[model samples]
Target: MRTNTGRLSTRRLWALSAAVLAGVGGAFASVTTGETKATTRADHFLQARAAPTTAMPPTATASVTTESPATTAGRPVVSPVLPFNAKLTSSDIPVRGGGVRSGACSGSLIAPEWIITAGHCFHDINGAWVGGKPRYHMTVTVGKLKDGDPGGHTAQVVDVRQSPVNDLAVAKLSTAIDDVVPLTLPDKAPEVGQRLRFAGWGSTSATVVAPSDHLKRGEFSVAKIAPTTLEALPVVPRTVENSPCADDSGSPYFVSGDNRTGNLVAIENSGPPCPQPGREIIARVDILTDWIRTQTGDTAR
Candidate 1:
């Protein structure tokens, strides 16, 4: 499935422009001089985009590109803080190898020790397989506002449960977090054209990484497309197109207007790659309440 990187903030747009110009010029020369080597580099780039760097155990063998520390310092946090809400941080859930190495989806805290994310984000990395047992190897960080580094608390996944068809996963944290308040889930499906806010530690601009692991949040009108429209998209499992990209996987998609009464509608899933514009697909949280309650032992209305 295509991963959806959120739109860039104005400040980030300027920084990305400068970086792209400088890097693209150098990359062009390298591509021309060594086409074979360029292919390998391209492959690595695509692989990073497809799988989370930290999806596997430390012993697992996989090739990953490491960015320079200098570049890391310049990256900005993408989402702005709302009056009563805290943006979800990337550090809350650092992918094993750091950044986009983990599949690029976002997640949200539903209970003290339970987080909700997309099932597809925990799918097979090879993309050759269809359905099977769900994997919980991806690391989840909560309450962080920055990327790579979790501000304070961190937790490893104890278990993961996925819904049969929808892209939903409920994960148990190693320990309960006391500081970060868990968000609530609604019993009803979201309305068409309802304004919603999606928060994550994902890429700021389409293709480029935002500097900090800080939580980034954005507003999107829930363009309720027909389920048939989603079925027509070229997605895996022949399903929807409401997922997040880059660092957004496993992030929360929440309603914004009512603040205290807002409901979490979906978990970040997948979307089109950077430079390609598309809608994000999220695993509908309300649809799978029974499954979630059974797995996480949380009451779902």
Candidate 2:
């Protein structure tokens, strides 16, 4: 299937239909009944690029650029760009043998040249993640607190490497981003009830599905810990006010309160539309810590 930004291909349509049947496109399902069901929308690239009808406000201030460093979770916080926005220009993929086109999703910067995101973000038109070359091109923007913030970096994704054990992937940028601090990997998986904070550029609400122009964060608690996934329930602003929405896949979940220096326990994997109150499913990064370090050639111990 050709992946150029033209009309959607039949195979792409079929893959999306298959995801809906497989319960993967829950990002588009609705539960406004005011009744919380165990809903988790693991969107596999279902993009409806609406205008920024409701972009969530930035959670952190221009702290990255402050004259004096502040602290959170007991560590000095440098607002350098760690999390980022990955903008895609491909068809909405349900699974990248050519899916996961998701027009945009949050990404975690672990190395100056490497970024880890949900594996679903890259694939062929057939929904297969045949790593190395991506069917479509992608651009990454970081360092900026919000769109138009001049203090950041931008790069084109030149290559990609997908995970075999989890819903994760690491993309190689055209150039190194040595100025910003990268988020640290975890030494162990998170425990149930552990508190975490996450930020993203995904939609603010289900109804406002456009990816945000800035990063918005909220608090959540680890409800269940699995080998490859962590189920978390939002708590900070309550469920409906803030949480992952469409195009939020691959955003980071900081174990320490200080996101800048904290250990990334998880990455936004899938969730029902924004503020679902139901647990939002995130992919475990602990499972791929070594894999990530190896990918970036960062062997420091």
Give each model a TM-score: 0.57, 0.70
Model 2 lDDT, residue 293, Cα:
82
The list of candidate 2 runs beyond 4 A from truth reads 1-102, 237-241, 257-259
Model 1 ranges off by over 4 Å: 1-46, 49-104, 128-137, 147-151, 208-212, 225-244, 257-261, 275-277
Give, for candidate 1, the lowest lDDT window spanning 10 residues. 33-42
Give all candidates' CA lDDT scores: 0.44, 0.59
Tell me the deviation in Å of residue 217 in model 2. 0.4
Q: Write down the TM-score for model 2.
A: 0.70
Q: Give a tens-digit lDDT track for model 1, residues 1-301.
A: 1222333221110001223324442111111211111011112112443345443344332212122322224542221232212222222123335544423345667777777765544434353212233332445555445555313344555666655444456666666755555677677766666666666655555445432245555666565432211111222221112323355555666775544334677655444453244455444667566666777676544
Candidate 1 backbone clash number = 46
- How far off is residue 189 in model 2, in Å? 2.0
Q: What is candidate 2's lDDT per residue for 119-235, written digit by digit as tens?
A: 767765554555786655566766655675544555667788876555677888876766566777899868999888777767665554556776777888998765566778887
